[model samples]
Target: MDDPPRVGSTDVAVLPSDGGTNQPTVTEAPTTPTVTDSPAPTGDRTDPEQVAREFMTTYPRDVRELSDPTFLASLEGVNTALLDQVTDRSLEQAGHDSDETYERYAYTVTGTYQGQVQAFYSMVVARPAEPGEGGGAAENDLPFQVHSFDWAPGMIGDEDRPGPAAGKPVPITTEEREELIGQVRTDVIDPILTFDPDESPEQRQERLDELTVEPSTVTPPMSRSGRYAMIKETLSQTYSTEHGGPITITYAGTWVDPYDPTHNGSWSLTAAMAREDDDGFVVRSVEETAPSEGSG
Candidate 1:
């Protein structure tokens, strides 16, 4: 007989304890550890604006800390008691139906290396569950789920076009501009196309048409490594926003259809110092995609 195999998280396993034993020996049964799903967090303020502000402040700090991969990995053994509390409460208040549903709203870094941030924004098309079957919350019923979750540094940011409005015409500060551009090229664009398995030849052509860029002409080649240059060249034009604060800079421009550059689309990019980290800033999140490059 051989040593009994250890049971795993999924199910129990049985094995002989000794090869030479004449009589059958019983091995101690593995005990199942009790795991209680934690409760959610609660906010004291009733105002939505106040809640949003609090969320903006606290989450960013957490994000800043999460930027450190080695430190984050080492914390795997530690219980996320407080973090779970807040996330759970927020989900419950929002009436999210299932943990899986909340996951759709949340983003995760799929793969990363060398301190570069890698991520993907995916569509979570969850249908409403029937009665007696668990389903996502009312809010979860959408064509697509969206959120910006960064796994590593230099993961994502603004396209190379104009800065967000609300600042001087030469909107971005010297230090801030470089950081913002770094993020856009490294973080936001890389992950989306890298994980886009369906973006094959046919899909690439379709993407070209959708993005309104010339097909068959590989200005710099559209591989993941060269996507930043392609995107930068594609979106060189700029626009600005009306409102302003914190000397922030925002820009509005067209998201070109990569497949067909002749077509026009509308898009916007914004840049500002991260409220949590004095040295950092984020591109917020993106909004709708249009057909042409100029306005999309």
Candidate 2:
């Protein structure tokens, strides 16, 4: 049987040999650039949404790419339509600046795996509040920080989508998605994001122990402090009130590796119910389920 759903899961593709130059054309700091509509061209395959989904799927597995400038540059052959969709949706969902200009900083690049085509997504975010005037060496040198990521499954690959046998496959239910996300926050992502090397070992263990327990759907842990709290709050309000039904989520990427300090070296998969609860959903329990065939 397949493992249950759990929490998890950006774009950018730039194609080579196209009319446009490979080097970045826009140089100004991305302080809300005026985005213009591009002339329609033929044969664009890389889609932003697909790129985002691809980003989710691949990023965790290839952590080295995060720091690789050349690898980041090579992913330009992706379909912009998918890339745009995913970036637009994520930016809106994250409440980051979602203006069309943001797309200029995003890209979709494709890769081949097992004779199959895959995509990677990335965003070049401008660092906030830098010294010195705009449009100078600082602007040219690492002006926009490149955060490279992979396509997430549900939104990009065949596995993430509804099976053709099932008709337009149902998206993993929002309730299920949110619940899994909550558990991930509590158990994995949040702890690692908030870890303080300065804290006493006992305190660290205490926090880790708290994480081992299943989290309440209504009040989940957050990875980093500050804005992360707001993300949690937003999820709580959006999901618990509307989609707070029984659901399960599974951690599918780097989150599963034990050696990784990136996310507490733990990833989770969850199974949940279809309806809501008065106390809101509390994790009934946690256990390792059997992995699907071929995964083991």
Candidate 3:
């Protein structure tokens, strides 16, 4: 008998005929299927995450000319006209950009609007031109973009106008709530309340200069020193004394409805505090509304 066929080799056999010469027959072995890698999934242009990333990368460059139709077109699903309007208003409020060059960005999806994902986009950019050493990105959440609003003021009650979809409630732990309250009191309220009556106008103005960020629309409490003592006394009697007597802090994770012009972005923290005043129970608040540090 022929030697056992080698592995994967065709088998040969001899066929005997009654009166004819023997012929060779060949049998083929089974072939193995070829393997190939499936093509990688293409980045979906409509995917909100993908779009948000692209936006973060491109916005710093595009913001220089926010009204450019070509630039606006790149922002898919955005209201171009409204974007232009807001850009004009923003420029009026914040003034033109200087020499800051944004190189890196981080973003978090906070909510969705009009079926598009909304995010807070933060960037690492050259700090404002300063003497001695250069400044870095603010340690606190001062500068960030509310992607859902297209970095513009969102529509409040204009049902006729296109607006962002209503954001879902963001849940936070009690610890988080307490922490945020502390931050508001420390970063926002303390600076407002800690003023010296003896300080001259120039000294007070210097203090205001330190506290005020560009495009500050909210009237700083330092501007109203007359009420500082009263506000402090009222707060002390209302909230916990150990924590510097913060007001009753009502924290909203995202934006407040009706569109607060004072707030920087939708994701900015807003706290409403109740205090006893001559007008009975009234709301006293200082909206920091900046994103947290290193969040970018």
lDDT leader: 2
Off by over 4 Å in 2: 1-104, 110-126, 129-142, 152-155, 160-207, 210-296
Q: Name the Cα RMSD for model 1.
A: 24.5
Worst 10 residues of 3 by lDDT: 19-28
How far out, in Å, is residue 234 in model 3? 5.3
Give the per-residue lDDT digits (tens) of candidate 2, residues 187-220.
Answer: 4445433435356656655554443333323222
Backbone atom clashes (below 3 Å) for every candidate = 47, 60, 4
Misplaced by over 4 Å in model 1 are 1-173, 189-195, 198-233, 237-241, 245-273, 293-296
lDDT of 2: 0.30
- TM-scores for every predicted model: 0.22, 0.23, 0.20
Better model by lDDT: candidate 2 vs candidate 3: 2
Best TM-score goes to which candidate?
2
Deviation from truth (RMSD, Å), model 2: 18.8
Please give the TM-score that candidate 2 achieves against the real structure.
Answer: 0.23
lDDT of 3 by residue, 97-182 (tens): 22232211212223334454433212111111232234444322223221111122233223376333212111121122224345
CA lDDT for candidate 1: 0.26
> In order, what lDDT does every prediction score?
0.26, 0.30, 0.28
Candidate 3 structure lDDT: 0.28
For residue 220, model 1's alpha carbon misses the true position, in angstroms, by 18
